[model samples]
Target: MTTSFPDPAAFVGKVAFISGAASGIGAATAGRLARLGARLVLADRDAERLAAFAAQLATQDVLALNVDVTSMASVEQAIAAGIAHFGGLDLAVNSAGIDLPRCATAHYPAEDWDKVIAVNLTGVFNAVRNQIPAMLARGGGSIVNVSSIMGFRAFAGQPAYTAAKHGVIGLTKAAALDHAAQGVRINAVAPGFIETPLLAHLSEEKKQEAAMLHPVARLGQPDEITSVILFLLSDAASFVTGACYEVDGGYLAR
Candidate 1:
């Protein structure tokens, strides 16, 4: 028996940039695109991990950058360097994010809130702003930002995470409309809790509790979110823009 995958020719000669590529959904998306024939620029704050992961890819056509998304200069430089290396940019996945320790809204630490918003919200802004010009230069391109189910729903003890994700959806929509006519299509993926490093610290019992929160009764895998991200970044979704696709397993339905 054979397992089939999407046609790789669709991504031939394409160049892709992915932040947070050291692990989880970002790594999954990078791996998928690499397999689909796209040259990659992989970015993460973890230099060691990013380098190791890039080395393990099937292709040598990978540029791994250690980037702190919270820094605009760092993101801009990475994109510039990637374009210089790959000739141009055709696709991007902005998945870099961080969560604050759970706390009440009134008791949330100002510094932690700042850090979360910096990495989760401002970091995405930095990536998008830096990437748009490069994409526009190539005539047009596709971008997928990783939001969360919390973007639309309220979660206790996660005020910072919730707000940043909500901002990402709004930013995705606005950026999409602004560049839609110019040929650049921007969309967002709102994923449910997945088996990512972010959730690795949770106890096994807590993990199961989270899974049961969804109708599917199981946690989503990183590849599951990556699949939707690939669709949004592919020509198959040519007409898609300003849209936030929920990749949740019926979590939002109830």
Candidate 2:
């Protein structure tokens, strides 16, 4: 069925909490939502970067906090601060994640495996666990967990990343089932390679090769993914939940 898009003002006066807000898709999403008039709580482990970015917004409606999503306590505190500051929460985006060194599953270092799962998988769990109550207290809310194309398919030498992303989709579905009837909608966005700071380390040739992997023959821009995320969080997607939206450049289709 066709659906009308939500008005730009749909999120006006709403409160949104975003993790990994210091850079990449998280930062882009925050800016877009803020422009739509949402009061924002931005969190990231990079305290300096988080504060600097939040300073650019420079409004009382914004709260910047250092949040280590791998730690339940850290996530809890950050959410609590947001709720206390804004008095309620209507939306959340769990975007804190890391990419570990590439290696075959058998050759992957156990330490890298632990760190990836901790940040990507467990981090989403912590956010969702803390966010649900805050959202419920506000009567209802929406959550978007950032997964990856690797979540559904696999790439050689990325066992840790693939496994963690796959777990995020599973977590998103399970959470949606548990909370859908209660008014909270949970879903995941599985993005293909996007041009973000995370890709800065790649060599020019490697970047080109990566881009060519997509049928669209280019990398996705951060704002492109942000648009999809904002739609899902907005009422325009009121019927969408427990699903994964791929914002790839048709990479998965190939």
Candidate 3:
């Protein structure tokens, strides 16, 4: 395969796997990749949603799996099955994540911390570890982990979410450096508060308040982040690895 990729992304015929494919950024990424002509392996804990969404794509080259990103076994099995279904793996986007309700670090329940870390941080680890070897075996490939503005910035009353997102950045860097030599390009995209289902728990007033935090005075959309992800996955970013692209609309700038 040629390292040369097109400007928008040369996804045609590429076998791409994505976690958290039921909704939000994961769903948006999956939809876009499908349109771009990539064979898709979509996974999410929500089996019904995953199947429904996968079918809506109207593409024959799709495999929907109910995967729990926190489990190494689940993630490993998903990867192996995807490769077997599609023949080989070429790229991946690990976007499966969750956020707990606000709670001070001192009062944050241990279980909540574990849950947040398990899905938001360890989840990425499970995917990356499995994705790397698959890609390496095929010569080289790309992986994009979704980090957050919270990865570098602080969010009060949300200790677990803050810590997990921060860990994602560190993991992305470490994994990328370890595999860049082997032709696996790993990177992260840190989006500002996005108007995804993850924020459905917040009140309208709270959502507005959250929007104001960005200099753009609005939240990001899944497509905004998805576009950057496509670029990073494409050979367009062949020289780029171990980097975190902040799509925060100036949240980090503040």
Candidate 4:
């Protein structure tokens, strides 16, 4: 499907907070939104990388915060800093996540399971929990929680990641229902095998194998996923909420 966005200033004067903004999809989204005129709060655990990226953007329009999403206190502090800097927040995207070493569920390390759940599932809850009231104060806002195609389907060696992503979808739906009447819209985006820093360690052959998993015969790009996220955060998707949009290159279609 061809989509042409004519308005480059669709997000002008808007305040957007994005987690995991150090690199990959989050970094791509941050750049895109900034170009489209949105004031940004970029949060991530990688302080150096986050700072470098934020430095390239207009300093007056961006606040780079070092945040560990797994800790509720860290997330709260980041949100507080953003609000204090930008005055208010109008949109947010939760993209901080982690993947465990491949292993059967029974053989998975308890530590890995705990770490994954803390960063992925509870991390989203932390962001959402704090984001809601800020949006409520603004009278309305939008949120996009980044899930994965694995949220609905099973990956042989990703028990914790799968479970956490699935929980994100459920959380998104519940939040949508709870806030829609008050004008806050919550939704999710499930991306499939995107070419990001997460996959930078894969061998060329392994990357090809992953690409073949999608019917499109190739992996997706970060900007491709960013476009969908931008749409959800903008007024263009005013009627959208509690829905999970799959930008998976047909990976789940099969």
TM-scores for all predictions: 0.97, 0.97, 0.97, 0.96
In model 4, state the lDDT of residue 164: 96
Model 1 misplacement above 4 A? 1-5
Per-candidate total of colliding backbone pairs: 0, 0, 0, 0
Name model 4 segments beyond 4 Å from true.
1-6
Candidate 3: residue 167 lDDT (0-100): 94
lDDT of 3 at 220: 91
lDDT of 3 by residue, 53-140 (tens): 9989957999999999999999999999999999999999999999878988889899998999999999999999999999988999
Q: Of 1 and 2, which scores higher on lDDT?
A: 1
For 1-254, candidate 2 gives per-residue lDDT tens digits of 54567686788899999999999999999988878889999999999999988888735689999999999999999999999899999999999989866888888899999999999999999999999999999889999999999999999998888999999999999999999998899999999999988899899999999999899999999899999898899888989899999999999897
What local lDDT does model 1 show for residue 75? 97
Q: Worst ten-residue run, lDDT, model 3?
A: 1-10
lDDT of 4 by residue, 152-240 (tens): 89888889999999999999999999999999999999999999988888899999999999999999999999999999987788889
lDDT of 4 at 170: 98
Go through the candidates in order and give each one's C-alpha lDDT. Answer: 0.93, 0.92, 0.93, 0.92
lDDT of 2 at 42: 96
| lDDT of candidate model 2 versus the reference | 0.92
| Cα RMSD, each candidate | 3.1, 1.5, 1.8, 2.3
